[model samples]
Target: MKHILRTSMLVILIIILAACANDEATSNEEGNKDEGADEELKIFTTVYPLQYFTKQIAGDQASVESILPPGSDPHTYEPTTKEMVEIAEADAFIYNGAGLEPYAKQISDSIKSEDIKILEAAKGIDLEAHVHNHEEEGNEEGAHEGHNHGDQDPHVWLDPISSVQLAEHIKETLVELNPEQEEAFTKNFEELKGELEILDQEFHSQLEDLPQNKFIVSHAAYGYWEQAYGIEQIAVSGLSPTNEPSQKELENIIEKAEKHNLNHVFFEQNVTPKVAEVVRKEIGAETLRLHNVAVLTEEDIKNEETYLSLMKHNLEQLTKALSNSKSGDSSESEEQSDSDHGHSHGGDEEAQKIYDGYFEDSQVKDRPLSDWEGDWQSVYPYHEDGTLDEVYTHNAEDSEDMTAEEYKEYYEKGYKTDVDRIVIDGATVTFYKDGEEKFGEYTSDGYEILAYEVGNRGVRYIFKLKEEKEGLPQYIQFSDHSIDPTDADHYHLYWGDDREALLDEVTHWPTYYPSDRSGDEIVHAMMQH
Candidate 1:
């Protein structure tokens, strides 16, 4: 009887230990939900950098996630399923606000999470898009009378002054969440602010020696930098890097590149390189990197380089590129500009000829592929079957023979790489994701490529179809979430039934207009001043 009782007591003790272990695990999860649980600091942002900043300050104690994906364009990146979950669960979400991140509105609309704090990082600064004083020229004078994003340049991070504001806002949010770290975060922010101040001084002092006043940038996000540094940056697009420049604007850029003795054209690794390539080829100028500071790539982040290092690199590149321009290496380009400028020089004329021929030979879709049918091809955008559209299998006919190979090639070229997936039909070309089979299509105006490949195609332009509305082109381009350059290219699009316009409705630009500041007065100042 004594031995049995002892055995029973041992069994009971073992059971109690197991139950206690299970309860502890359960508490780790439900612990936060306890009535007296210490509230967690929730830091939400739209880009990766915001998360990086928050992580440094919060260490392991805070919850932080910037909703944007790695290698995704912040200008238009929408929320994902996981991101939606985070947004709803977050205590405070920080975004580089001002109409900078376009999807800010969409995320706000979709998520119904109550008491979630939303903070705009670009909160305090007044903004203007990267545009020249077009204000001088009235709307009647053919200014860019387009959509609603009037002069708001969202690249607050590019300017240290603005970055200070963003960092301070972030600190304030942290204080509200974990007041214990208020002193630590404030100290960290001040130190970070000092580094930024030094960067500002470096840029101003290093660029101070340049004989030129104006230079071209990859996009309009650098306006704050230009404003702060007293130099002008003519960019391809406003507030977004994906917007393509018009052929006219391109010509203007080429014309001015030579006219001003501009040495170095620049590109951003995070965005497409097509615009940069175009600028580089047009003037035959070398290209360099200007870190936009939105998010670092896997390579950049892994290298242990911070925003300060990248900014320093940009300064060095700018110095090297600008210094080269003054050395008189391309007298031929300038001389050619002098002779054929205004009337169209040899290069300008050649560019025009290429544009004309490319547009003339381009394919247009004239009908809907209600059923499906053809193979089409182009050389310039892709190469001989170089683009995915030109090389891929097409099943239908359009206003222009569509070239999926060419389309893929064009976007890939912008990204400074090749397309990742390909699927095609006589009427449609579908892109299979490397890991999935859910690609989107682009069949607008008269041209169509629908429901063939249905995976993520790594092609940034035609990524989303916006759930497709009724009647409209059955494939209107806008229905898709792509930010491709249409009317700015100096030519009309090729649809299957009838050709459609590009982004003219939103941008009010002419068919195939140039997207760069190639012809701006600043270029003249750089050369003549």
Candidate 2:
């Protein structure tokens, strides 16, 4: 009887100990869960770029998510009740403002909690005006049904420069929310800004010299590219992909395509290509895909595509379309004759018009020497100091046929300059060479257009020295890729006693930029070539 009682008491004690151990384990796990929730911020964004940028800047300090699911159009997407609740519960809500998300303002206003921080990515941006195809024809019904964003274009993130602004806004908001992670956020933001500037340089260099500048698109999302890179987008639809063109508008688009010799029609990933297909069939043109980077498709997500990869892909497609050969082959004699004519007379009238309007409007009036008035420094010193080596490498990487050494050598010659600095104050021009200053008063001589062997032309704005000064060239010519009068951001100058000789010398055109820019800034500017 004594042994039985002892065994039963021992078994009861063991059961109580086991229960206490299990309870302790559960309590510890719950505490860890609460601690983790407090350590990391929960951020919700409206689009893919914002989500990607937030993740990039926030690193492990925050958990970033997009309310829009994969392949969903932000233009038409309306969050469900559950999603709204989820967003309201987050620590911050970031959105691409300027009417990109029609429901974003509504959700933000309805949120009564002070815990959630709201950020508009394009808060201070000057948005481009959204022009509809039907707006010119007095089709109010169609215009209102298609586009709802009054006059402002909400797709500001399409341009890499504008994207930098968006990322900066996001970084500012994140720092405001979590000041403890400010250092990490700042480092990440700077890295992101550098990447974006490099991307911008790539776009500028690759697209600047293309023979064809106009491209047709199903939607007008690429207007920012036109504003930034000077490539014209002939959008068949309006601001929104759903904005279909009228019959007359369609005819006009086809006519413009034929006029510009456009061979490809660009279609977006998320939008259906029915109308685009109609236009393509009508024109018998090929099709290309241009991802807007607004949302990621299932395939894109599976392939792990980011904004950089998507943009590089878009660049490839653009190069292919722009450099596409004309419809048919020509005989050897015909080709030779055409080449000769192009060299002699700058190609046809259409080509001349296109070249004139390549960077700016052809109707720009003749500019004065005051346009070039600025304190300038030669880019040759930066090249010699190896500051521009990265730009050369980038050019080589993007080139299909050139090697790195070859590009470096080519730029070395192009940037060679003896004159180190120049200062243009009103009509007085001072050239600084070898620690000596040569001053001369210059007056504007009429501009001259010169045709290149490549079938393109450039305008040389000539400035004649009014009075002869020691060590001063008789005439100075300025070419900044502008046909009409505008303040030159930078310029390629040629000077000598003979005016005609300077015009013929095109191989060694030394480049110059503002004197205040740092080596990195000068390198960044040169990458835009």
**Separate clash counts for every candidate:** 75, 0
The C-alpha TM-scores of every prediction are 0.53, 0.56
Task: Please provide, for model 1 over 1-529, each residue's C-alpha lDDT reduced to its tens digit, 9 standing for 90 to 100.
Answer: 4433443454445345545554675667665566424655766778665776666666666777766655667755555444555555567777776666655654554443344667776767676454654111222222222222455767677777677777777788788766877888888878877877888899889888676766677766667766787777767544455555666666676677778887667677566558667777767664456777687676454445567766776676566555555344322222111100011212355333332222221332233221111111111223323332422333112215445554344334332212223332212333222344332334423333222122211111121232443322333231111112221111111222222333222221111111232322212311320
lDDT of 2: 0.74
How far in Å is the alpha carbon of 467 misplaced in model 2?
A: 68
Best by lDDT: 2
Q: Which 10 consecutive positions of candidate 2 have the poorest summed lDDT? A: 331-340
* lDDT digits (tens) for residues 1-529 of candidate 2: 4433443454444345545554676778766876665588999999898998999999999999898889998887867655665666678989998877877776676563566899888889888776554222443544543256677878887788988999999999988888988999999999999998999999999898898998889877887888888888887777777777777777888887877778778888777557778878777676567889999887577556788878877886677678663462111011110111121113355534533433333554577775676689998898888888887687677666678777668768877988999987546688899998888778888787777776555677898999887899999998765566444667788899999998887777777877877888766544543
> Which predicted model would earn the best TM-score?
2
- Model 1 C-alpha lDDT versus the unseen true structure: 0.49
Displacement of the residue 220 alpha carbon in candidate 1, Å: 1.7
Can you give the lDDT of residue 296 in candidate 1? 69
